[model samples]
Target chain A: MELFSIILLLVMGVATIGSAILALTTKKTDVAILAAGAISLFASIFFLVLASPDVAMTEAAIGAGLSTFLFFVILRKTEQNAEK
Target chain B: MLLSIENIALASGILLILIGLLGALTNKNIIRMIVAFSIFDTGVNILIVTFGYMPGRTAPIIDGAKVTAQNIAQVAIDPVPQALVLTAIVIGFGVTALMLVFALKMHEKRKSLDINDYTDLKW
Candidate 1:
């Protein structure tokens, strides 16, 4: 079980790093925001795998849902889609 | 090795931490940074819950039947994390609200959302 958990943890780590790299390197600000949100969503899944349902619920609700909504709201308002 | 619940929780906790770190460091927008803060908070919440779980444990409820003080004490899940998470949720909510307020204020001041545009203090 521990081994499996370790494997899952590794997978989660890879996803996190990948999304972070994308978020940082992406030229488009909107794409970066989306990647950032994806990282949060994956993190919530990681919380669920850890058997922390209460925390997982909060992560999914606030991290994934509300946070993403906030980012999208900003994106829409700013129209700052141009890459830097 | 057979999978167990403990392993599951541990995996999730680590994963959440990694993602939160990535989000915080990589995202550029101020609003996205605020969202990343919430994600990081969520990661902390996951760690708290992982601490609360005990193998072969039962709920802390007392029904006075098929549940005794010793039984509850010996196998009861830690209530500390649950309480901590509750407090964290409220605090996190407040922080998010404040972040929103700050974002709005900044936007109103600059009429811009780009973090790079705020260069008054920049060297």
Candidate 2:
């Protein structure tokens, strides 16, 4: 079980790193926002794997849901203003 | 030396922090910087929770049947870090919202997203 857990953690770590790289390097602003949210979603999974279900839920709700929504809303507003 | 859960989380947290710092420092767009800050925030939260992880222990939840109050210390991982990270997650959301608002205002004022345009302190 421990080995299985370790393997899961390693896979998640690799995924988070890959997504972080994507968030940082992506040229599209919308893609970067989505990648940042993906990082949060992956992190919530990490918390669950570490035996912190409460933290995981919170991260998923606020970090992944609300923040990403807010970013998209703000981005839309900014783009609209720019187009005007 | 073992690739335990805590060790893996710690390493990932550190690497994520570095990735966030790199993005924050190098990105010139206001929204991108905000994204980097959000990533940095997650890394910090992960580190906090990882430090409190106890191997072979279940979650800190106590229902008096599975994890009694008496044996919770031995049977469960630390709850304090979970609480801290919980607060951090909400606060991070608030902060990201604030930063987005600020970025919006900046964009409205200058009509640009580049950090170079905001030279209020330029000599």
Where does candidate 2 stray beyond 4 Å? Answer: none
Binned by DockQ into CAPRI classes (incorrect, acceptable, medium, high), candidate 1 is incorrect
Per-residue alpha-carbon lDDT of candidate 2 for residues A1-78, written as tens digits (9 for 90 to 100) = 888889988999999999999998888999999998899999999999999999999999889998999999999999
All predictions: root-mean-square deviation over Cα?
Answer: 5.0, 1.1
Candidate 2 lDDT over B29-67, as tens digits, reads 999999999999999999999999888889978888989
Docking class of 2: high
Model 1: residues >4 Å from true position, as ranges?
A1-6, A80-84, B1-28, B53-70, B119-123
Pairs clashing in candidate 1?
A1-B2, A46-B12, A50-B8, A50-B9
How well does candidate 2 reproduce the true complex, by DockQ?
Answer: 0.91
Q: After superposition on all CA atoms, how large is the RMSD of candidate 1? A: 5.0
What value does the lDDT take at residue A45 in candidate 1? Answer: 67
